[model samples]
Target: MKMIVGKGSCGIAAGANKVSDSAEQYIKDNNLDIDVSVTGCIGMCYLEPIVDFIRDDGTKTTYVLVNAENIKEIIDSELKGETLTKYEMPEVDKQRLEKQTRIALRNCGVINPEHIEEYIAKGGYKAIEKCVTEMTPEEVIEEIKVSGLAGRGGAGFPTWFKWNAARSAQGTKKYTICNADEGDPGAFMDRAVLEGDPHAVLEGMLIGAYAMGSDEGVIYVRAEYPLAIVRLNIAIKQAEEKGFLGDNIFGSNFSFRIRIKAGAGAFVCGEETALIASLEGERGMPRLKPPFPANKGYWQKPSNINNVETYANVAWIILNGGKAFSAMGTPNSKGTKVFALTGKIKKGGLVEIPMGATVKDVIFDIGGGIKEDRAFKAVQMGGPSGGCIPADLVDTLIDYKTLAATGAIMGSGGMVVMDETTCMVDMARFFLDFTCKESCGKCIHCRLGTKRMLEILTRITDGEGKDGDIELLESLALNIKSSALCGLGQTAPNPVLTTIRYFRNEYEDHIYKKKCTAHQCKNLVSYTIDADKCKGCTLCARNCPVGAISGTVKNPHVIDTDKCIKCGKCLSSCNFGAVIVD
Candidate 1:
């Protein structure tokens, strides 16, 4: 029998390493014959530090939240032929994985990423071998075209079109790049795949390089993902040792090579041109269109770029045939998409679901609804480039055209759920703040227009808003969207525009009534003590950092409103819930 522990970044953060070490020590001391191994995250990060037990009979059982303290008990229980229900993964979490289709993340949690043998055993590198030995470059591109696969980075442009463009472009040399510089706030889908299944991404890129007739490649990943970078480097070396990379693979004339370029975490580098600039050792910024990347990219050579998720689906599509993938989702958006489900959510982690699935299906059905049983308010789809989707539109289908109709893009798949406690006005301001700081200042409209909008939002949230502020914001957003140079600048106003479109009332309340409905803006909220509920235990007074509350023991406390910093310390410290926000 063998045990496999999850060592993904999430699992490591939750102390999986300690559990692995402890289990190894226990086995050494007891002279048990059990073998231990490691795998990547399984997407159930909420119950992390997971351990899977594989019996000799080939049956597998998973245990969640395993740690050093309980590893012995679990091992002992398993050895005695007894079941420990508490340690087992809950059925609800299992159902979360069951209700979805996993394509890009197929081998993520199942295989040992460091071992090429494991990946080869699971049909890795076969697609590229097929391309090199039997299929022609045109045949490979045709299969992708039939699959209806688009760029999964943000823009849903046809994958076949880009590959075809690079193949047909007039250039002596060409390049293939994977945009792994995922800078979205709540997105980690790329990171998880890189750490869990690096070979899958490499294999997909190999197929793309063959199809596009590019002999050189680069993966522009952010330096923040050290684990992903390390694993990717390891996978690349292993592939090279196995003759999958470098000159003339499978004894064919198709020679290709790939290298890693670590980015400085600039959000604009997510754009293809900006990424190319960074890869060339220049400042990360976007260039003009017309001479798009396919024509003159990376030292004026033809180049094709796709994000990690896009490349991950390539091998799958080639192996299974494109029609098999095209049959899954809506007409416009085919196959499945990977999402980094986060923010005010109960089962927050990675989620992979088919296209056309409703927002409610992901949040309520798969995500297990809002945290603390709070009322769902809105969800921020995509990232700063995307827009907010209100709860009223929970049933909206998650397709490129449909989400675009609701003022949101299917950007890089970041689903940030918001509860009733989240203020829509403030949320818009938050995204605007991120976009404003990330702007490359190449476009005057995006640089100054986003700044002007952010200032107005700040004033409104701080209770200093004036008349016509909403109109001024709308005008600036529209102007910036039209005049910006690159996609980063063009979509910078998404959050502000989307909030104004869906939740105008919240903005009006902040501007006209001088009130924040969600009680999130501290300037518009005041803390007060409830006499009937206050036990006067001095917990609130002692916990208040500013010493704003005053009272003797056993007496009702009084809050000095002028001195209170609006930090909500009293409400959290009080046992009887005496503090209230007004």
Candidate 2:
């Protein structure tokens, strides 16, 4: 009998390590004959620490939400060929699985990341072998061009065009870079791929090197992703030992070597120019690009850079051919995208869906809808730089063009769901706050413009907005979008602009009525005690940290507005629901 447990990031976060340890201890104590192993994320991150048991009869049973306590039960039941009725089986939908074309994440949770042979067993380096032996540099580039694979790192630049530019450049020593500096908040898709399947990325880079006529490659990963960096380092060493990375790799003249360069967790390093600067041991700032990276990049030589997920897809493209890879997604966007679905979502985790899948399908069917059955308000795609899409557009297909049309770019695939409790005005203000702090201050328009927009949004949320504040915000957003130096500044206004487009009523109510409809604006909310519901209890008065509630035993309570701190402690303390915030 064999048993496998998920040990991916989400799984670990859900206590998969504790479960595995306990299961092993239980097996030892019971003297059970079972093979226990660790795998990666199975994608259903909501029910993580998933355990799979293979019986002697060759039947496989998967158990979801397995924790440390459940290990004893699993050992007592599955290990002894007894079924546990407590754990329900997850239903598999072929449509959901078929919608995703897992080229980039093919081997993510399927193999042990630390073992080189497991990667080899899964046909890992076969693409590089074929590229080195059978295909010429021009043929490889042509194949990628025909495949219609675009960059997955925010901008949908054609991958083949980048390769051809670098290949045709007049440079003896070209460089290839994998931009693993995934700094987007609430985004862990790239980190999952790098940690769970490092070899796939390495293979993709090798193929990319062969296609672009590059000799050296660097993986610019952030230092914060310690697990991913460790796995990548192990994979690099394994590849070198197997003659896949060094000179005459796999018994061919093509030679490529890769090195890991740790980023200092700068969000701007995800940009190509900033990445190149950091790789060159300089400040991680975007430089002016007349001579793009393809023309004169990295130490002033032709270089090509792609995200971790993009590189992970290359080996699959080479193996499966262009048509097979192209058939899965929309005509223009020919691949499945991995997204870190989070925030207010019931089933928040890593989800891989086709390019044309509707946002509603993802949020409802896949994500199992919002947590606590809250009314869906909006979904924030992309990151802080992205926009909030209204619920009416939930049926919109999640393609690059469609998302772009809604003032949101298909950024590094970070989808955060929001519910009715969320105030759009406050949401916009929160994102502005993030962008204002993250602004590099490289350009005058972005530096001054973001600060001004944030100020206006703050004023609106605080019920201090004047008549023309909205107009001022719109004007500042336009100026920042138009005059900013890079993508960071250009897209920083997306949250403010999109919120105004979809939830203007909320903004108007705040400005005109001086009210926060969602009760999210702390300054606009007033704490009060209901005399009838008070029941003469001094609980509210006793629990009030600032002594705002005034009452005696067996007497009705009253709130002192001047002394109230608006912390809502009285609301929780009153058993009869006497205290309320309006």
TM-score: model 1 vs. ground truth = 0.98
Which pairs, if any, clash in model 1?
Answer: none
Task: Judge candidate 1 at residue 13 and give its lDDT.
Answer: 97
The runs of at least 3 residues in candidate 2 whose Cα sits more than 4 Å from the true structure, single-residue gaps closed, are: 92-101, 553-556, 573-575
Error of 2 at 207 (Å): 0.8
Candidates in order, TM-scores: namely 0.98, 0.95
Give the winner by TM-score.
1
lDDT of 2 by residue, 341-402 (tens): 89999878778877888889888887879999989999998898899888999988888898
